[model samples]
Target chain A: MIILDRRQIEDLIYLPAAATAIRDAFCSTSRGEVNLPPVGHITFPQVSGDCHIKYGHMQGKPDFVIKIATGFPQNAETEGGTGNGMSLVLSATTGAVQAILHDEMVMTDMRTGLAGSIATQALARSDSRTVLIVGTGPQAMRQIESHAAVMGDHLNFEVWGRSASKAAQLADKLGGRFAVRSVSDLETAVRSADVIVTATGSTKPLFQSDWVSAGTHITAVGADAPGKQELDVNLVARADLRVVDLAAQCLDHGEMSHAAVQGLIAGQDVLELGQVLLQAATGRKSPGHITIADLTGIAAQDIAIADVVLKAYRAKGGRDV
Target chain B: MIILDRRQIEDLIYLPAAATAIRDAFCSTSRGEVNLPPVGHITFPQVSGDCHIKYGHMQGKPDFVIKIATGFPQNAETEGGTGNGMSLVLSATTGAVQAILHDEMVMTDMRTGLAGSIATQALARSDSRTVLIVGTGPQAMRQIESHAAVMGDHLNFEVWGRSASKAAQLADKLGGRFAVRSVSDLETAVRSADVIVTATGSTKPLFQSDWVSAGTHITAVGADAPGKQELDVNLVARADLRVVDLAAQCLDHGEMSHAAVQGLIAGQDVLELGQVLLQAATGRKSPGHITIADLTGIAAQDIAIADVVLKAYRAKGGRDV
Candidate 1:
C-alpha cells in the first residue's frame, strides 16, 4: 500500500480541490443521498474520543466517501500531540486502498475554511470589498486563503490577533493584497469590514453585538469544542440569518450552543449549510441583513477531502502524491 | 513515526515473549484497576463504525495498559479488501507513545493465542500432553506456537482442517517434537486428545457432545464473531466448567450466545477467565471433569499485547526486533 508522510500529504494534496469536493459532498449528504452514521464515543478521566463514517454522492459525482476521526484532549499525555487525527479513504465503486492522511489539524482548518467560504459565497454581498478576520493561527491563514480563492479580487482583508507580532506577520505574508491589524484596533477593523471571520481558540466570546455593523457577514470557526466560545450570544441572536455546518453539532458545541442554552435560537431556528448551498433555503435575504455562519466541522468534509486525496494520488501514478 | 510494512513487522516482532507479556497484562487488568473507557459504535445500512478507548491493569501484571481504536467500513473499499483498523498504545505510568499497530486481525490473532496459552497453563492438567487443533489457519498455527512455548516438552499435537493438505502440512512442520498427526477423523481426534482447540471459521457447530470425552479441556476460539459457532449447544450445557474471556461479550457474540439463546446455559453459569486466573472463581476441578474455555477476543487483550510489543520495541532500541 502507498503511504504518504506528513510532508508529502501537505505539499501534494490540493486544498482548493478538496474544499470544492467537500462542499458538494455536504450538499449531497443533506439531500438524503449519503450514508452518514451517528458518531459514537467513550469518554473518561482526561481523554475523550469519537468516530463517524459518512458515504454520499457529490452533485453529479456518484462516488461514496467514508471517514473516521478521533479527538484527544490537547493536554493528554501521548507521544503525538493529543489533537492529532488521521483518516483512511476507500473507493466506493472499486474497493481499493485510496489514501491514508495525517491531516488531523489541517483537515479541521480546511473544512472550516470551506464552510466559511461557501457561506460567504452564498450570503455575502457581491460588492463586499473589505474583510476582517480575528485570530492569527493556521486556521486564520486558511480562512484568508479560502476567502481570497472564492471572492477573488473583490475583497481586501484585515486581521487581528491576540499577539500583534503574529498578526503583522500574517499581514506581511499576505503582501499588498490585505491590511492586517492588532486586537487593540479590532473594533475599527470590524466596523469597516463588510465580512468578518473569527478563528480564535478563546473560551469566552470576543465580539460584542454593538461591534458589528449593518449588512455584514460573519463566519465563526473557532468555537468547535464544547465550552469554546468566540462570538457573543447576543451577536448570534441578533443575526438576521444564521447557518451551521451541522445543526445538532453546532447546538451542542459550536457558537450556537451558548445561544441555544440562553433560548436565543431554538433547535429549528438553525439552517444547515447544505440547505443554503443547494438554494433550497435563502442565505442573505438583503444587503442590509446581518448574517452568521457557525462552522463546527463535520465528517462529510473529511470524507470528501479523502476522496480528492485518493484521486490525486491515483492520478500521480499512485505514489508520493 | 516509524512505519513498518507487513513483511517488516512480521520479520522483526517476536511472538513468544510478546505472548507471555500479554498474558501477564491481562491478569493485571482483570483486578478492577484499569483506566479504560467503554467501547462504543454505530452500525446502519449506510455506515458502520466504532470508536473505543480502553485502559486497565492485566490481572497479575504491575503495569497498566491503554489503547484507542477506530474504524469505518467504507475504508475497506479504498484498501481493496477490508477497511483499515488502527490502534495507538500508551504507557499508563509515563503516558508515552509505546507503539502504533495496524491491521486489527493480526493483533487479534496474536492476543487471542496468548490468552489461550495463559488459560491452558492455568486450567489444563499438568499431565495433559496431546492437543487436537480444529483449524489450520494463521490463528491455529499461532495457538500451536503459543501452547508449545508455555507447555514446552509436555505437548504433542494433532490437527484437523477442512483442507487435508493444510492439515498434513502443519503436522509435517510441527511433527519433529510433538508427534503431530493429521486427522480427518475429527471425532477420534476430539475423543482422544487431552486439549482440544477449536479455531475454525464454521457457522455451524463443528464438534458434537458425544465427540468430547470426559477430562477433555476444550479451548474454543472460533466463536468470537456473531453467528459463528464451533461446539454444539449440548456440549456447552454438559461441560462441568465453562470459562469465558469476557462473560458479557460471550453472552452477546461468543459461543455462549447460542447456548444462552437455546437455554442451555444461564448467563451466570459461565465464569470469566480473568476471575479464574485470579482465583476469584474455579477452573477445572478434577482430572476427570470436562472443561471448556470460550475464547472471545477482547480489547483487554489488545491493550495487553500492545504493552508487550511496546516494551520489546523499546528494549531493542525501537527497531524491528
Candidate 2:
C-alpha cells in the first residue's frame, strides 16, 4: 500500500472536485447506497481525549474507507498536539489494502468544509455576500477556502471570534483571494450577513435566535457530537427550511438535536442534503426563507473524499511501496 | 509511521510471547480494563465478501489498535486471494499513528492460533499425548504450530480431513518437529485423541458428540461468525467445562450461539478464558472431564498482538518512514 503523508494529502486536494464528490456522497448516504455501521468511540477521561472510528462502503464503489480521528485537548498544552487521524482505502472486491492517507485530520476538515460550502451554495441566495464565519481554527480556514473554491471570490467574507487578534490573524492568512476582515460585533455580523457558518466547540448556543434575519442561510458545523450546540433551539425551530446531512445523526447530536429534544421538530420535518440534491425534497422556497443545514458528519464523506485522493495519486503515477 | 509487510510481521512474531500477550489481553478484557467497542462490518453480497473492523484500547497502555480483516472467498477462486487485513497502532496519549502492520491476515491467524494453544495448555491434562486436528486450512496449520509452540513438541498429532491428500499434505508439511500423520477414520481419531482442535469454515458439526472420549479436551476454533458451527449443539451443551473468549461475542455468532439458541445454555454457564486464567472461574474439574473453548475473536487480542509486533520492530531500531 502507498502511504501519503499530511503534506502530500494537502497538495492533492482540489476543493471544487472534493465538493462535488462530497455532495454526491451525501446523496448516496440518503439514498441508502452505502453501508455505515455504528461509529466506534473510545474515551480517555483522564486526559480529556477521545478517538472515533468511522468506516463504510458505498455500493458499486471500487474501494471502502476506514477512518480514525482522535482528539486530545490536554496534549496540546505540552506536546504541541494537533489532533491526528488517518484513513485507509481498501479494494472492495478483494479487500486488499490499497492506500493509506495519514492526513492528520486534514481530510476530515476539508470534507467538512466542503459540506458547509455545498450547503451554503445550494441554499444561500444567488446574490449573497458578506459571509460570516465564527471561530478561528483550522475548520474556519477550511470554510473560507472551500467556500471561495466553490462559491467564487465575488463574495465578501467576515470573521468573528472571542479574541480579536486571532480573528485578524486568520483574515490576514486567508485575505489574498477574497475580501475578508475581522469584525467585533457578533450580533451585527449575524443580523447583516447573507450567510453564517458557526464552527466553534461551544456547548451552549453561540447566538440568539432573534439576531438572525430572514433570507439568511446558516450552516452549523461545530456541533457534531453530543453536548455540542452551535445555534439556539429556537433559531433551529424558526428556520423555514431545515436541511441535514442525515436525519438520524442530526437528531442524535448536532444543532438540530436541541430543537428535536424540545419538540420543535420531528424527523419528517427535515430534508436530507442528498434529498435536496436529488430534487426529491424541496430546498429554499423564496428569498424570505431562513434555511439551516446541520452537518454532523458521516463515513460516506470519508469514502468519497478518499476516492478523490486516490484518483489524484494514481494520476500522478504514485507507486505502491 | 513505520509500515511492516506480511513477511516482516511473520519474522517478528514469537508465538510463545504472543500466546502470553493474548492470554493477558483476555484477562484484561474480563477485568473491564479495555475499551472494546462494538465491531463494524460491511458485506459485499455480489462477491460474497465481508470485512470486519475491530478496535479498542486498554487503559494505561501506550497505544490502541484498529484492525481490519476481510474475507473474500470468491476472490480466492479467481484472484488468488489469501484474504487481506491490516492493523493500525496509534499512541493513546496523543492518538498519533505510530505504526502500521500490513500483515495480510498473518497476525490474525497467529493470534487465533495462539488463543487456541493458550486455552489448550491451560485446560488439557498433563499426560495428554495424542492430538487430533480437524480440517486442513491455514487455521489448522496455525493451531498445530501454536500448540507446539506453547505445549511443547512431545505430543503426537493426527490430521483429519474429507480429502485424504490435503490432510496428508498438511501433516507432511508440519511433520518436521513432531509425529504427525493423516488419519482416515475421524471417529477413531476423535475417540482416541486426548485433545481435539477443529479449524474449518464448516457450517455443520464436523463430528458427532459420541465420538469424543473421556479425559478429552476440545478447542473449537472455526465457528467464529454466524451460520458457522464445528461442534454439534449437543456436544457443546454436553461439555463438562464450557470456556469462551468473550461471553457476549461467543453467544452472538460462535459455536456457543447454536447451543444458546436451543435454550441449552445461558451466559452464566460459560467461563470466560480470562476468568479462568485469573482463577475467578473453574477450568477442567477432573481427568475425565470434557472441556471446550469457543473463540469468536475479540479486538483485545488484536490489540495485544499488534503491541507485540510493534515492540519487536522498535527493538530492531526501526525508524519512522
Candidate 3:
C-alpha cells in the first residue's frame, strides 16, 4: 500500500479540487448513492480523549474509505496538540488496502472547512461582506482560508472567543491575507455580520436567537456528536431556510437535534445540502430570509476527498497512473 | 509510527504469548473493564464483499486498538483467497497512533484460533482424545494448530467439509503435526469425536443435535454475524453448558442467537467464557455433559493480540523499548 505522510498530503492537496469532490459527495449523499454505516467511537475520560471511526462506500466506485480521527484536549498542554487522523482507501473489488493517507487531521479540517464555505456561499446573500468566526482554533483558521478559497478575500472577517488574547492572536495570524480583527462584543458582532460560523466545542448555545438579524446566514459545525450544541434552539427553529448535510444525522445529533426534541421542527422542515446542490431543493428563499446550514461531518465527504488525494498521488506516478 | 507488514508480524508473534494476552482480555471483558463500541460495517454487493471495523480500549491500558478486517469471496477466483485485515494501535493518553500492524488477517485468525483453543482447554474433558474440525478455511488450520498449542499434539484430528477434496487438502496440509485425516461421514465423526470445532461460513446447521454425544466439547466459531449459524437450535439448547465470549454479542449475532430467538434459551441461560475462565461460573459440569462454546469474536481479543504484537515490535528496539 502507498503511505503518504502529512507533508506529502499537504503538498498534494488542492482546496479547489477538494471543494469539487466534496460538492459531488454532498450530491451523492442526498441521492442515496452512498453507503454510510454508523460511526464507531471510543472515549477515554482519563485524558479527555476520544477517537471516531467513520467508513463508507459510494455505489459503483472502485474504492471505499475508512477514516480514523482522534482528539485529546489535554495533549495541547504537553504535546504539540491533538488533532490526529488518517484515511485508508481500499479496493472495492479485492477488499485490499490501496493507500494509507496519514494526513494528521489536515484532510479532516480541510473537508470540514470546505463544507462550511460551500454552505455559506450557497446560503448567504450575494451582497454579503463581513464574516464572523467563533472559536480561536485550527478550524477557525481553516474556516477563514476555505471561505477565501471559495468566496474570495474581499469580505471582512471577525474572530471571537471566550479567550480574548487567543482571539486576537488568531486574528493577527490571519490578517495578512484578509481584512480581519478580534471582537469582544459577541452580540454586536452576531447582529452585524452577514455570515456567522460557530466552530467552538461548546455544549451550550453560543448566542441567542434575538441577536441574529433577518438577512444573516449561519453555518454551525461544532455539534457533531450527541450532547454538543452550537446554535441556539430558538435560532434553529426561527431560521427561514434550514439546510443540513444530512437530515437524519442533524436530527439525531447535530445542531437541529435540540429544536427537534422540543417539537419545534419535523424531518421535512430541513433540506439536505446535497438536494440544494443538485437543485432539487431550494436554498436561501430570499435575501431577507434567515438561513442556517448545520454542518455535521459525514463519511461521503471523506471518501470523496480521499479519492481526490489518491488520484492526485497516482497521477504524480505513484501507482495505476 | 511503526508500520509492521505481514512478514514482520509473523516473525514477532508467538502463539503462547498471544494465548496469554487473549486470556487476560477475556477476563477483562467479563469484568467490564473494556470499552467496546458497537461494530461498524459496510457492504459492497457488486463484489460480494464486506468490511467490519471493531475498536475498543481496555481500562487503564496505555494504548487502544482499532481493527479493520474485510472479505471479498470473488477475489479468490482471480487473486488469492479472501481474508484481509490490519490493526491500528494508538496512545490512550494522547490519541496519537503508535503502530500499524498490517498482519493481513493473521492476527485475526490467530486470536480467534487461540480463543477456541482456550475455550476447549478450559471446558473439554481431560481424557478427550479425538478432535473434529468442520471447515476448510484458514481458520480451520488455525484451530488445529491452536488446539495443539493448548492441549498438546497427542490427540487425533479429523477434517470435514462440503467438498471432499478440499477437506482432504486441509487435512493433508496439517498431517505433518498430528494424526489427521479427511472424513466423509460427518455424523459418525461428530458422534465419535470428544471435541468438535466448527469454523465455516454457513447459514444453516452443519450437524443435527442427535449426532453429538455426551462428554463432547464443541467450539463454534463460524457464526460471527447475523443470519449465520453452524449448530442447530436444538443442539445449542441441549448443551449442558453454553459458554459465550460476550452475552450481548452472542445473543445478537453468534450461534446462540438462533437459540435465543427461537425462545430455546435466554441471556441467563448462557455463561461468559471469561466467567468460566475466572472460575466465577462452572464449565463442563459433568464428564458426561455436553459443552458448547459460542465464539463470535470480540474487540477485546483484537486489543489483546494487537497489544502483544506492538510490545514484541517495540522490544526488538523498534520504538520506546
Candidate 4:
C-alpha cells in the first residue's frame, strides 16, 4: 500500500480541483451512483475523544474509500498530541488496498471546507462579496482559502469568535493576503455579510434568527455530533430555503438538528445539496431568499477529495507512495 | 506512524500469547471495560464484495484499534487480486496514530483462530484427542495450528471438505509434522472426534443434528454475516450448553441466529465465553455435556490481538516507518 504523509498531501491536493470533484460526487450521489452507510462512531467519553468511520464506493469507479477520523477536545492542550485521521483507498473491483493517507485530520478539514465552498457556490447569491466566518479555527481558514480559490479573490472576509483576540489575530493574518476585519459584535458582522460560515464545537446557538439578513446564505459546517448546535432553532426555521449535505445526518446532528427536534421543519422539507447540484430542485431561488445549508459531512466528500489528490500525486511522478 | 507488513506480523504474533490476550479481552468486554460499537458493513452485491469495519478501545489503555477488512468472494478466481485488511492503532489519550498494520486479513484469521483456541481451552474435554476440521480453508488450518499450539501435539487431526482432494491435500500437508487423515464421511469424522471446528462459507447445514456425538465441544468459527450458516439449526438447538464470542452479534448473524428466529432459544439462555473465563459460569459443565461456541468475532478480539502484536513489535526493536 502507498503511504502519504501530511506534507505530501498538502503539496498534492488542490482545493479548486477538489471543489470540482466534490461537485461531481454530489451529482453522482444524487443520481444513485454511490453506496454508503451512515457514519459509524466509537466514542470514549473518559478521554474526551471519539472516532468516526466512513466507508463508501462509487458504482463504477476504480476506487472506494474508508476514512477514520478522531476528535479529541484535549489534543491541543497536550504536548506532541493531535487528533488523528486516516484514509484508505482500495480497488472497487478487487478489494486491494491502493493507498493509506496519514493526514491527521487535515484531509477531513479540507473536505469539510470544500463542502462549505460548494454550498456557497450553489446557495449564495452571485453578487455576494462580504463573508462572515463565525469561528476562528483551522476549519475557518481552510474554508476561507477554498472559498477564495473557488469564488474569486474579490470577496472580503470578516472573522468573529468568542475570544475577540483570536478573531482579530486570524483577521490580521488573512489581511496580509485579502481584505479582512475582525468584528467585536457578532450581530453587526452577521447583518453586514452576504455569506456566513460557522465552524465551532459549541453546544449552544451562537447566532440567532433576528441577526441574519434576508439575502444572506449561511453554511453551518460544525455541530457534527448529537447535541451540538451553532445556529438557533428559530434561525434555522426562518430560512426560506433549507438544504443539507446529508439530509438524514443533518436532521440527526447538524445545526438543523435542534430545529428538527423542535418540529420546526420536517426531514422532507430540507433539501439535499446533491439534489440542487443535479438541478432536481432549487437551492436559492432569488437574491432576497434566505438559505441555510447544514453540513454534517459525509463519506462522498472524502472519496471525492481522495480521487483528486491521488490523481495529482500520480501526475507529479510520485510512484508507489 | 509505524508500518508493518504481513511478514513482520507473522514473525511477531504469537498464538499462545494472543489466546491469553483474547481471554482478557472477552472478560473486559463482559465486564463493560471496553468501548465498542456495532460492526459497520459496506456491501457491493454486484461485485460480491463487502467490507467490515470494527473498532474499539479498552478502559485506561494507552491505545485503541480500528480494523477494516474486506471480503471479495471472487478475488481468488481473478488474476493478481486478493482481499484487503488494515488496522490502525492510536493513542487513547491523545488520539495520535501509533501504527498501521497492513495485514491483508492475516490478523483476522489469527485472532479468529486464537478465539477458537481459547474456547477450546475453556470448553473442550481434557481427554479430547481426535479433532475434525469441517472445512479445509486458511482459517481451518489457522484453527488447527493455534489449537495445537495451545493444547498439545499428541492429538490427531481430520480434514473434511466438499472437495475430497483439497481435504486430502491439507491433511497430507499437515501429516508432514503431525498425525492427520482425510475423512470423506463427515458423520463418521464428527462421531469419532471429541472437538470439531467448522470454518466455511456455506449457506446451509453441512452436518446434521444427529451426526454429532455426546461430550463433543464444537467451535463454530464461520457464519459471521447474515444468511451464512455452517451448522444445522437443530444441531445448534440441541447443544446442552451454548456459548458465543459476542452474544448480541451471534444472535443476529451467527449459528444461533436462525435458532433464535425459530424461537428455539432465548438470548438470555446463550451464555458468553467471557462469563466462563471470569468463572461466573461453567463451560462444558460435565464431560457428557455437548457444548457449542458460536464465534461471530468482535472488535475486542482484534483489539486484544493488536495490543499483543504491537507490544511484541516494540520489543523486537522495530522503529518508526
Candidate number with the higher TM-score (1 or 3):
3
Regions of candidate 3 where Cα sits further than 4 Å from its true position: A77-81, B77-80
Superposition-based RMSD of candidate 3 using all C-alpha atoms, in angstroms: 1.7
Instruction: Report the candidate with higher DockQ, 1 versus 3.
Output: 3
How does model 1 score on DockQ?
Answer: 0.14
Docking class of 2: medium
DockQ of each: 0.14, 0.73, 0.83, 0.69
Candidate 3 backbone collisions, by pair? none
Residues A101-209 of candidate 2: C-alpha lDDT, one tens digit per residue: 9999899989989999999998998889889999887888889998999999898889999889989988998888778999999999999999999887778988999
How would you encode candidate 2's per-residue C-alpha lDDT over B216-261 as one tens digit per residue?
9999888766788999998989999999998888899889999999
lDDT of 4 by residue, A58-110 (tens): 87888899988888887764221245687999887777789998888888888
- Give the per-residue lDDT of model 4 (tens digit) for B27-82: 99889888878898888788778888898888888888998888788776422124
* lDDT, candidate 3, B34-133, per-residue tens: 9998878788877778888889999989999999888787776322248787899899988888888888888888899999999999999999989999
**Any residue pairs clashing in model 2, and if so which?**
none
Task: Judge the docking of candidate 1 as incorrect, acceptable, medium or high.
Answer: incorrect
**On a 0 to 100 scale, what is the lDDT of residue A49 in model 2?**
73
Worst 10 residues of 1 chain B by lDDT: B76-85
The candidate that achieves the highest DockQ relative to the unseen native structure: 3
lDDT of each: 0.69, 0.88, 0.89, 0.86
The residue pairs found clashing in candidate 4 are: none
lDDT, candidate 1, B1-321, per-residue tens? 444433434444576777666665555556654533443332222444333333443333433333333334445332112323444543333333334465444555667677888788778877899988998776787788888876785688889998989899878877775667888998888889899988876789887899888888989997755667998889999989988877777888788899899898998899878788778787788998888888866667776666555565567787632
- Per-candidate count of clashing residue pairs (backbone under 3 Å): 23, 0, 0, 0
